[model samples]
Target: MATALPAPAALLLWECAARAFGLLYFPPPTSIAARAYHLWFSGPPAHLFLTAEAVEDLLPSLTRLVVGWTLAAALGLATGLALGRLPILAALADPLLHIGRAIPPPALLPLFLATLPIGTPTQLATILAGVIWPILINTADGVRHVHHAYLDTASVFQLGRARRLLYVIVPAAAPKILAGLRLSVSLALIMMVVSELTASTDGLGYRLQNAAGSVDVPAMWAVIVLLGIAGIAANGVFLFVQRRLLRSGQAARPRGHVLAWQQ
Candidate 1:
């Protein structure tokens, strides 16, 4: 509640200022709220509180966002683990990885469009390229720093490679991995909007661009507000998962401590 208080206060301030200034371009917060309700939720609550426009516009963007981010996360984790486990391989790829990271993710959109058929594939590629780096880097670094004592224990216990990775390495590196994931989630949202704005017939970004082009300021602002809400929801959910995972990891640590002590 303390964290959430500022948002309402900020909105109240915005509403007051916009109303007082009577700016033609800046729709008062109240007007934006009403517009949002009409555009997305004026329909009967029986329809899961979604309107036609939202079904057409919002859902597709969300689907693309989820798919792209999931793919990036998986790829990043796999690649990071590989690199972290094999220092030689990481050294071999370091230059190439750095070069790729240097290039801005959105700048590759045209290349992706040329290579892949338009629509979802292109958008996914763009978002993945944009957001994968943080997770990849963080995971690699975290896993690389895993205490050598842990690896020695795994070896002494004759643990299989899979068990070492899943039961030992991943949990040890989870905090840093989650930090990277949080960053990538924000990047994914930003890239999603950018990809839509650059090329797409529909989605929140397209709608935002369309509103701006048509001088529909209130509608534009409403879309921005909706995007903010979506981002907040995503981050909140992910943070909850991160906390649960961390707690589980903590619970498992004592067993490892006992084993090490016995060894």
Candidate 2:
């Protein structure tokens, strides 16, 4: 209850300021909210109240965001684990990894556009390029820094390589990996919007660009607000899942090896 006050309070303040100043560019929140509802949520109940515009734009954007993020997460985790487990490989790849991550993702949009198809492929590539670094870097760092005691314990238990990784390395590194994932979620959302801003037919970003091009301030604000809501919702869901996973992992710990996990 306390935490929710800030947003509503800010919106109320914004509403008063916009109304008082009669700002053409910054319309009141009421108008923006109305525009958003009519634009996206004015459909019939059978269609889940999604307007055609929403169906055409919102769904595609969500699909791309999910698919791109999933692919990046999978690749990042796998490569990070391999590199973390192999010091020589990590050493060999460190320079290249740094260079790759250093380049801004948006800067590569042109290259992606030239090389890939202009629609979903380009968007996915952009998202993957942008969001993979955090996950990879954090996962590697977490896995590499996992206390040697954990490894020793695994070895003493005669655990197989896969078992050791599943039970020890991954569980130990879960927190850092989850942190990376959380960070990447925001990056993925940003990239999703950015990737749609050009060379695409439909998406929230495309709609935003269209609205901006038409000088539709209310529509633009609506898109911006929707994006903010999406970001907040995504973060909330990620945090909930993270907590649940951590709790389950802790609960699943073997009694005999509890001290090792605690350490």
Candidate 3:
């Protein structure tokens, strides 16, 4: 949806021009597009065919992403909540978080390679570990940022813990929590491909690395472009959801003129 404009065409023109100068490194636009088309519309890609059909590929990568990212999200939310609500826990773990996030996920491949068995499982773990931090930190910060006034209001109303959670704390903190997940959604995908780059026999990342390895310019270019599109689409979806949720939140706020209530 984001690319449904004349601007993409302009990019295609530039891509074509870039290729003209360096054919070896930069394949033509039509060639890359054709290769991308082949990935989706061709035949069974799991095994060799007369030609390529990559349309089915999104499912495998997405399945891994769903599993890994969901796990990360669950952990992130739980950890964020605990840390955000408890200063002591936050103090204990925040430093580790700051340190861990500084290291890139790819740099850890050698460690994973040596420690974990080589296969799909390792890839899943890589994506999960890489993506979890955003969720954890964001949720904690969101939870921390929950207004004291809200808590006080809940107390005055004699609201039960469940009611307080449902009506006050969650609403106040949800935007930031979602913000973290939004970030992880993209981070998870990048790591998903990165995992495949080193570990997988299949998937888009594998296709990209293999293409570069064998000099299949078309296929390499194809997967790279598709990956770019996928990343962009994921982010766009997150932003759209965030805006919608924020709008709903605004509408749900208590609406009344201030009649000058004094404590």
Candidate 4:
């Protein structure tokens, strides 16, 4: 209750300020919510509550965000695991990875645009580039920090490389990996908006930019609020899943350790 009040309280203050000042630039939260409803949710239930504009703009943004983030997660996990486990590989790749991580994803947008056409691929590439680093680095760090006792137990049991990684290292490192994923998700959302703003006719970012340019303050505020809602919703879903998975992993861990130690 305490946590929830601040947001609503701030919004109420904003409403009062906007109304009292008759501010044309900063529409109140109520106006923004109404604009959002009119733009995206003023539809019959049969249509799944999304206006045509939502189908045209918001859906594409979400699709790109999911696709790009998924690809990054898969590749980052694989690369991170390999690098984490193999000292030789890590040594060879460390410098290159550092260099890559130092450059911002948006900085490479021009190269993406020049190489790929100005479309989904380019945008996905840009987002994937930005979001992959945290997952990769964090996963690698987590795996490296896995208890040596676990590895010794795996060796004593004569567990194959694949089995050891899947059963021991992954489960132990999952908490940190998931933490990285949360960061990656947020970065993915930001990159999605930025990529659209840079080169797209539609999506929330482009609409926000267009609204601002056209002096549609209410519409601009509506887009910003929608972005915030989307971010909070995505994070909520991820954290819920992370909690369940981690709990299940923890439950199974003692059995795994006992079996490994006995062998």
Compute the lDDT for candidate 4: 0.89
Q: Clashing residue pairs, candidate 4? A: none
Model 3 C-alpha lDDT per residue in residues 129-213, reported as the tens digit of each score: 8999889888888888776777777799999977987788777788888889999999999899989888987777777888889
Tens-place lDDT per residue, model 1, 1-263, is: 79999989988888888899988888788899898888778876434767778887888899989999999999999999999999999999899899988999988999998999888888999999999999999999999988777888789999999999998888878899999999899899999998998778889999999988999888999999889998999899999999998888777787766465346
lDDT of 4 at 113: 88
TM for every model, in the order presented, reads 0.91, 0.94, 0.85, 0.92
Extract clashing residue pairs from model 3.
39-54, 39-55, 40-54, 40-55
Question: Largest TM-score belongs to which candidate?
Answer: 2
Error of 1 at 134 (Å): 1.1
Model 4 ranges with Cα > 4 A deviation: 43-46, 255-263
Q: Using lDDT as the measure, name the better of candidate 2 and candidate 4.
A: 2
Off by over 4 Å in 1: 1-9, 43-47, 255-263
Off by over 4 Å in 2: 1-3, 254-263
**Pick by TM-score: 1 or 3, better one:** 1
Candidate 4, number of clashes: 0
Q: Write the per-residue lDDT of candidate 4 for residues 62-101, one digit (tens) a residue.
A: 9999999999999999999989988899999999998999
